[model samples]
Target: MTFVTKIRLQSGNRPALDRIVDEIRSTAERKGAELRGPHSAPPERLSVPQYKSTAGDEHRQFRSWDYTVYTREMEIVGHNELARQVTEFDFPDGVHVEAELKQVEQMA
Candidate 1:
């Protein structure tokens, strides 16, 4: 039996996200674990309009706030301990990580 760990990392701070991904990749390589990739996904763009009141033309001069969220994914195969450590690893502020583990049975 082998465990497959799927990791998803996202952050508004691109530099921080890239740094975390690099660290995970290096750690997996040092452990000689089967690593898949740090695949990048299209960034999510969000916009919000800032206004003091819902309906007020007297002072309705406002700007739209924009933010971009970057995302990356990686897969660890047959490395339960390593995966656990990664999931428990402390990440920097503005970076978010989500990990999922699945058990697979080998077929002869």
Candidate 2:
């Protein structure tokens, strides 16, 4: 049996997101754990309209906020403890990480 840990990282700040991914990659390397990748996904763009008042000011019609969320995914193979360590790492502000573990059976 093997456990595959899938890690997903997201943040509106690209620099912060890259930094966290680098840290995780380096840590896994240092621990001699097999890491699949830091595969990047297309950035997700989001926009929200802003209104200062219920009546809606003249400027509010064109007022909106836009942000891009960058994402990266990686797999940690057969290392539950290492996966835990990576998941428990203290990441700086503006970065978010999620991890999922799944069991896989070996084929004969």
| Predicted model with the maximum TM-score | 2
TM, every model? 0.88, 0.90
In candidate 1, what are the lDDT values of residues 6-89, reduced to their tens digit? 999999999999999999999999999999989999999999778878775546847878999999999999978899989988
Clashes of each: 0, 0
* Model 1, residue pairs in steric clash: none
Error of 2 at 66 (Å): 0.5
Put down candidate 2 lDDT per residue, 1-108, tens digits, no spaces.
999999999999999888888988998999999999899999999998878777868575755889999999999999789999989898888888888999999999
lDDT of 2 at 55: 87
Off by over 4 Å in 1: 54-61
Error in Å for residue 37 of model 1: 0.8
